[model samples]
Target: MTDPERELNFAREIIGQRGFRDVPTDEVLGEAERLLNGWMAGDFRMERPKLYDHYALLLLALLQKNRDLEARIEALEARDA
Candidate 1:
C-alpha cells in the first residue's frame, strides 16, 4: 500500500505556479542542503547557487516521479484486488 494522496500533495504543493515560481529562499536552500548531504556530497563543486539554475528541472523531474509512482501503485492495487 502507498499514501498516494500524500505523495500527490507534496508534488502538487511544489509544482503549483506560485509555489514553483516563488519558492521561499530559505526552503530552497534547505532542499539543496538535503541534496548535498545525500547525493552531491562526493561532488564538492555542486554548490547551492548552482542548484538554483536547475530548480525548475528538479521540480519537473519530481512531478514525473510522482506520476510514475501513482501509476505503479494503481497497477499493484488493480492486480491484487
Candidate 2:
C-alpha cells in the first residue's frame, strides 16, 4: 500500500529538484490565468504554448508594456496632429 502523504512529499521533492516554482494566485492576472486554464485544458490547436508560471507572468508583463507603449504613442500622435 502506498502512503499518500509520503508519496506527495516525494513528488514535491522531485518537483523542487526539477526547478518547479510556485506562483501565488494573486500574482496571476486574469488574462494569464485564463490562458493557463486553456493551455491546461488543451483548448488550442497546433503547438502548445509555454504556460508555466514564469511564462504567464512574463507574458502579462509584455502585454502590459505593449499596451502602455501604444497608449503613449497615441497620445503623442494626438498631441502632434
* lDDT of the candidates, in the order given: 0.52, 0.45
> Measured by TM-score, how close is model 1 to the native structure?
0.41
Which candidate leads the pack in TM-score? Answer: 1
Candidate 1, 36-57: lDDT as tens digits:
4544444233434545656664
> Would you estimate the TM-scores of all the predictions?
0.41, 0.37
Clashing pairs in 1: none
Question: Cα lDDT for residue 52, model 1?
Answer: 61
How well is each residue in 1-81 modelled by candidate 2, as lDDT tens digits? 333233122222223344323533233344454544554565522122322324645455557667878999999999999
- Provide the lDDT at 39 for model 2: 45
Candidate 2 matches the true fold with a TM-score of: 0.37
Off by over 4 Å in 2: 1-51
